[model samples]
Target: MDPDLPSSSLAVVLVRARNPLNVGAAARAMSNFGVKDLRVVGDYLQPLEAARSAIDAAPVLASAQAFSSVAEAIADCTLVYGTTALGDRDLHHPVDVLRDAPSHVRQNPGRTAILFGSEKTGLSNDELSHCHRLLTIPMARGGVSMNLGQAVAVCLYELHRDAPAQRNLPEPAAAATADDLDRFESLLRETLTAAEYDRRFPGNMGANETRELVRRLGLTSADTTVWMGMLRQVLWKLRQAGR
Candidate 1:
């Protein structure tokens, strides 16, 4: 949570948003929370101007870089989070940012970006795929959802609450991320195939089961690398033994 580094490490990305006012408002909100970099993805900034919202934080808007796709905007970032409303995306876990934000940022420091989609349709599943995790603010169920500015404010508020961050996390001596769990799933599936574990079912294990079981372990980045390393060794050892 090193304050200076924290501010620099995180950014907000708006993807194909059609509202100019919301764009301006979001940039203003981000600056208020000590975030200086805002990357907007669209053909250009016309919609942002139409919203008439970010005028006060004009500098942020002035320098905002526009990208054609989400990947280019977030590619350099090591940790990326997307905002989502869907519950059926089985490969990723649905985490409440309010309860999970602090720990997540503390653990994964570097160029990080949180994404918001267009006002009309929200983020696509493919756009979300680029993110390692998802963030959403809870609201009373109804036809209304928070406007883009409001959403930005709330997220920054939570992010800035324990202001001027100091990196305070356990630095997991052993663990893995959802991505690592994904790779593990592949490895396990291959092993199961080789061992004929699928003969009984003739298909394969459900992905939800894989995600849930690995997520239960809360593996750190380091933990995943180590675990994969060990897995390779164990497999090689078995091969040598058989020979």
Candidate 2:
């Protein structure tokens, strides 16, 4: 994929990054691959200011946004993925090796956020909870981790390597934004509650589980609208019967 192909839809998010040099390298990689949107979660002002001095990375760093939380950083995105090194930690999201992730990303046709964790510790479980899936770069040895800058470069190369030379057809409808999906989930929860499904199926009512289920549907903009309408109607009918 050429940088032009997915640049508009792809965003790079760094969580709790503490090193200015690594941050600079990550920005350079973004420039090399053509992705321009860079979002940093947590306190990043010092590092971000220093990173602006990196070679050819000034533009990317200049436009970067510092967000307080991952959710806020990715709010406008329709798909969210976190990078992980499969350690002993138990995981709730689907995992994809780096080689296979770009295809899935391309299929979504919406704004997508790819998150990188801090140097000392990868994303916490709480941080990972917001991601729809996890992506890992396969390594020959277990327990070995790449430098934050290298990881960013590798992932960008893979994502930008498979682009067609030219595009000739109309683009497909974009997927629903994360913000819109959040609303859909809320409405669906209300409908399920109105139908007493939550009481009957307590095991399935976990907030994270419900969120994953909605994301798995891969709903487009039109699909989200229709689904929301259907849920609203169901909720109204259930209330009417109760009255």
Candidate 3:
């Protein structure tokens, strides 16, 4: 993983992933490739919590963002690719084999999102419509399908495999970041303390670890403000209960 490039402009978006184990596995893959951004499009929040609980999952999973829809999830991304195994369904968008897709992904200097559908159904036609293109991992047999977790790992590996040479391409626009992530960290710490999480799980995670967790979220300045507000509200409610 190249610390300098950091792949800050790249995000992995999971759509309606029903299995918590698969979510955790996908996050672990993102961690392996140094892709810090992970977005999930689903109404259920349990998978996110379960994934975060995985012992092997990195801070990437911990900071993963949730959205109610694919459009909302990929809103910040300038380019979007949907992954598919290729079946009887008609694919409207151009398809790129997994290995060759990385070049096009690197072509965009803005944020790029790769969407992975659920373990059972794969991406629906409506979902695929939002994608600029589709990516498929070549299989040994025409009909064999890859597991959701394994597919994520393979795509991430392909994206990261050629990073050194791809860096020569135009640099992506600077990603929006929180006020150095300090303000968000401070608010988060205060909220955690108010909720007595620190007392209950003493030394479970330290101040530095908390800071790193917030940093990994890769929130823009606007996102930080929203988080700050939410934390403050939580703190207010906690204090009210203590009264």
Candidate 4:
């Protein structure tokens, strides 16, 4: 099945990447696929060189939180996926990465951190145990290992391919916005004027614009009612406070 929330419940855990350019490139790849977070163990982004490498993904680098050890890096993640080329060890699945891709990511997630080891050894066995399972890139024999950044990019893209596109947050409920309220008040005034009501408008200004704003914002019924209450409060003030 396709992933539900997308934004990849995925995070890349790079242990001693050993190259600023690779880290930056990985950050860029993370940003590209909407991976949720990253955790790097060992010295990382020492001089912000990774941010420069991230290109337009500077925000990803800037916002990337850090950790000291592999266990610490993954402590908060509920499902942990590890990547490895040397599967000579005792792993349940010998050489398949995509077999149960979506379930492994979505089945368990307070967060899911996909671990990538150093540029040289991939993940050490100690790091491997921390993971719930493995995500292996299928390759023909004699294929050179994937570049670190490219490896992360491929894994994240595969995991999130079917998930929905997400923005930082849902547009704050339109009703909760001052901008929406202001437009609605303006519309109430204009609608009254257009019906030969508020004389101050004369030619009836701000009505069309206000209505358009409300419509464009996709205001809900609840939003209209809230605005109506606000207008009532304003009208009560117009009674001159029992003067």
TM-score of each: 0.60, 0.64, 0.64, 0.59
Model 1: lDDT equals 0.73
Task: Give model 4's clash tally.
Answer: 1
TM-score of 1: 0.60
lDDT of 2 by residue, 21-82 (tens): 98999988988888899999985467777787666555889999999899899999988999
Residue-level lDDT tens digits of model 4 in 114-180: 7888887777778777877777788774234679999988887777766655656676654445655
CA lDDT of each prediction against the hidden true structure: 0.73, 0.88, 0.83, 0.68
lDDT of 3: 0.83
What ranking emerges by lDDT with the best candidate at the front?
Answer: 2, 3, 1, 4
- Measured with C-alpha atoms, the lDDT of residue 14 in candidate 4 is 84
Error of 4 at 213 (Å): 57
* Candidate 2, lDDT over the whole model: 0.88
Return model 1's CA RMSD, one decimal: 20.6
lDDT (10s digit) by residue, model 1, range 138-207: 6675234568888888888887786644567765465565677889767766665555566876544666
Better of 2 and 4 by lDDT: 2
Model 4 CA RMSD to the hidden true structure, in angstroms: 13.1
